[model samples]
Target: MKALIPTGDPAEPVVLADVPEPVPRANEALVKVEAFSVNRGETFKLEAPAPGDRPGKDIAGLVVQPAADGTGPAGIARVVGHPMAGGWAELAAVPADALAVLPDTVSALQGAALPLAGLTALRLLRTAGPVLGRRVLVTGASGGVGHFVTELAAAAGAEVTAVTRDAARGARLTELGAAAIVHDPADARGPYDIVLESTGGETLPVALARLARRGTLVWFGQASRTPATLDFFDFFDGPESAVIRHFHYLDADTGLGDDLAALVRLTAEGRLHPEIGRVADWADTATVLTDLRDRRIRGKAVLTLS
Candidate 1:
């Protein structure tokens, strides 16, 4: 089997190499991967040399072997999931608890895009509590998680305002159901009930300021790669009720498989749409990682395993 791993090169970090097949534990499922998606966090991890040289987490495929305990979909059922690592291979040994059975109507490409980003967005929204008729704000609206946040917020009847640095992608976000689009954080109509903010640095302070009373700000990603400086005076001056919460996708556990199942169902029903920026052969993993790290790709990038 072949798997993609990070080499110690800044210009081109990922490389594909032959690897031994994994033997699943009694509680795991062996999935024969058909497609997978590259995530920005995975690319960021490449900056520091990978200890085991293993990469990848999100995968969508058919079940070759089900869990020994008979927990999830079995016998050639299509599924999407996240392994701790080594998902950039022909087969991945995923915990049965993390695997979601994909509907027949969804493609592997779309399902592959769901696990990491989709789960994060779902969890963030869940953290923000009920969004119906509330004012919600989503930053980095063109990115994978951002798009999901925007769509999910809107579907829940929230008045969604999407923020993107790129003007061109604004129309697509509006189509995704954002009630309004703003290019800068300052332009966002504020006192938002729920703010799903991904970009850090200068934007964080502004987003915090926009939170309404009892509003929740779910900070997930640091795309800016700069430190976020918090002003105690600015944050505490007023809006004492506003809450700032930093969300790391990995922290919320126990519902990944169920959340992924719901996302797949939403996608298949056309209520949630995943934006696939590019699709490439598995061998082109290096290029895909480079594009994602450099922000050359607008949305999720998919790699297909032949």
Candidate 2:
């Protein structure tokens, strides 16, 4: 089998090489991968490549073999999955619980784009509780998860303020459902009921100060790669009982399959759109990773198998 393996070199982080095929566990299903999406975090890992680092998490494929434990979809189901690693391969052993059958309306490319970003947006909204008629702010509102957060938050009736420096991307976000767009988080008006922030660094404190009373700030990523500094005085002037919560997509109490199914359903219903900014052959995975790391791609980047 051929898979992308880390080469331990910064310039050429990964290379397609012959490797042993994965053997699925009893609770896992073997999928013949059709497409997979590249994420920002994965590109960071690629920068400091390790010998055994496998760089893939989102995959869409056909279930060639079901779990031995009799879980997951039975009989050659078309599915999207969130695997721990190695999803870039021609085949992946995915946990049954993380696999969701995709509707015919959803393409493999869309499915590959859903698991990480879509799940994060869905769960972030869930953590914020009821968003109807609330004020929500999403920093780093131009990326994959941010795009989903903007659309989902707006669809739930929240007055969404999306922060992005790009005018073109902001216009698209408005079309997707953002009520307002700002070039920076500092430019956004405050008293927000919920804030989904991921840019980190100076942006985190600015977004935090905008929270309303009892507001929840869900911090998920630090795309800027800079550390945030906060002063106690900054919090003193903020709303009462403001909460800052760290979010991990895998921390949900619900199974991934259920949430993935919901995302696919929404896509099928034309409510949620998977924002795929780049599509290329798996042969160009290295180039796609570089584009993602350099922030050249707008949203999600999907690689199709030839």
Model 2 per-residue lDDT tens digits across residues 262-282: 999999999999999999999
Cα lDDT computed for each candidate against the true fold: 0.88, 0.92
True lDDT of residue 302, candidate 2: 98
Residue 144 deviation, candidate 2, in Å?
Answer: 0.7
- lDDT by residue (106-204, candidate 1, tens digit) is 999999999998988888888888999999989888889988888888888999999987876888888889999999999987878888878899998
lDDT of the structure predicted as candidate 2: 0.92
The regions of model 1 sitting more than 4 angstroms off are none
Q: Show the colliding residue pairs in model 2.
A: none
TM-score to true structure, per model? 0.96, 0.98
| Top-scoring candidate (TM-score) | 2
Q: Worst 10-residue stretch by lDDT in candidate 1?
A: 246-255
Candidate 2 residue spans exceeding 4 A from truth: none
